[model samples]
Target chain A: MIKISDLRKGIPISNDPYGDLAKIFSMRKDELIKILNDMVNKGQIIKFRALLDHEKLGYRVSALIAMNMDDENIEKVINLAHITHFYVREKNEKFPYSYFAMAHFFNEDELKSFSKKLDEMHINYEILRTVKNLKNDVK
Target chain B: MDEVDRKILIYIQNEFPIDDRPYLKIAKDLGLDEFEVMNRIINLYNLGYIKKIIPKLSKSYIEKYERALVAIKANEKDIVKVSEFINSFENITHNYLRDHHYNIWFTISGKNFEEILKQIKIITEKLEIDDYIILRSVKSLKLDTEFEVKK
Candidate 1:
């Protein structure tokens, strides 16, 4: 079985995958191709993707919005284009919100608009602007 | 970004070809020169727009491991120290400081719930944190990280 650490090391964050992956894995082109294909076929690999920086792509603001709402209202939140990730989590007395979403906006105005829409829908939510990205390395 | 650049970004963000000559394939599909596609991608990477091109693992594949989003309410004075301590764990993939009562939020994954709880215990004990919550994901409504590039 392939170790997760080895897999992560073999595919470090870079734009140039053609040169980096093979060299890091120390495998021939054909051998590496077969391994990658096998992993994909086994459902271990989803798809190759380019992780873009939304901030550099004109998204100047990002926020984590936690919501306390029913399941019926989730589709409304999902319909919003700015929401990148949405999840339903176990809630408790201290953390009363069960739903969480991460959204990116072009500016604070966009966030305000989003908040207004949530208000119109009567969705109880708290928008927490991301202060700093401490770490985001692939696990 | 121009129209062509936007198109390239959209295509790659959705499905980057996993082939020996992925860029060449992208160029062919977009009816552009291979060199131009390669140059554009490299430029985007250099400008910090494209963080990386990586093989995303399947959700089901990773669901074997228990994962939870832990939120910690650390004092402003010790925020930096607390974050550094959390980042030291390889199991912790994402750590972010947000403007809220539970300021520090991070996602951690482990082989089981007990293992994850053990790690959290160590962190809480070391940092002497009393106010925190572990929000285990029950259902993921939408988890796509890709942002649609607009022209």
Candidate 2:
């Protein structure tokens, strides 16, 4: 199947990719529009988005942070600044962390400061610094 | 990145002109030559500021598939094996190694919650590491995001 992720890839939308999509499913044009519209209404589909190189644009200090919080308090923990790609994950016995986020900052000190505040609040956390984006492709 | 380049980047966020001469249209709007706009975009890509210009598909397109954020706690010996194992899954989109006890974090895409659990069961049994957590996006605060370039 030609996945939707493959469609939004910044390629020229030329022959090969489009041709590949055509090969996949057989559906009427009008039906696809209606089906896509229905999905969009239910929050099933975020219609459009852009993935930027924030580091190149000067938001260099970026990392994924996981915060330990109980089920009821996950939302409160994530009410921080500049946090995108946020999620409330399940908590386990071994690792109590239940929230995840991507933080982008222009300065490393700012990022350190944010982490320090979380620590001061007695919120256990882990900073998963991205060493290198090995495979960024969204399958 | 200079003013001209910044202008170019700003124009293409979430979309680009769809035409035979798309760059030409972009150049016209920015009051720069087509080649200049193309050159700056190319430069940005080479500098790693621009990953690639992708279509930015809708998340709903795969609404049928189940997805979750999974954190697997593997020991030092099994870290590499676990990472490789997570990468092997078909719909596992983004994978990462965090500096936490649950070092291996990856997203799993499946038909439903049961399918994800099945993948986890099979892998944990094979690798002999049973500790992990699964997090679903209960509410997507943000997705398909774009960054603003300072002038």
Candidate 2 lDDT over residue span A8-66, tens digit each: 54453222322233434464434444554454565544443235577668886768887
Task: Give me the candidate number with maximum DockQ.
Answer: 1
Give the clashing pairs for model 2: A8-B54, A8-B55, A8-B56, A9-B54, A9-B55, A10-B53, A10-B54, A45-B60, A89-B135
Q: Model 1: residues >4 Å from true position, as ranges? A: A1-16, A136-139
Q: What is the Å distance of residue A93 in model 1 from its true position?
A: 1.0
For every candidate, how close is chain A to the native chain A in TM-score?
Answer: 0.84, 0.62
TM-score of each: 0.91, 0.71
Q: How many residue pairs clash in each candidate?
A: 0, 9
Docking category for candidate 1?
medium
Model 1, A1-139: lDDT tens digits are 4554465432543445655777776767567777778888888887778888887788888999999876788898887879988888888678788899999999889999999999988999888899989885432
lDDT of 2: 0.64
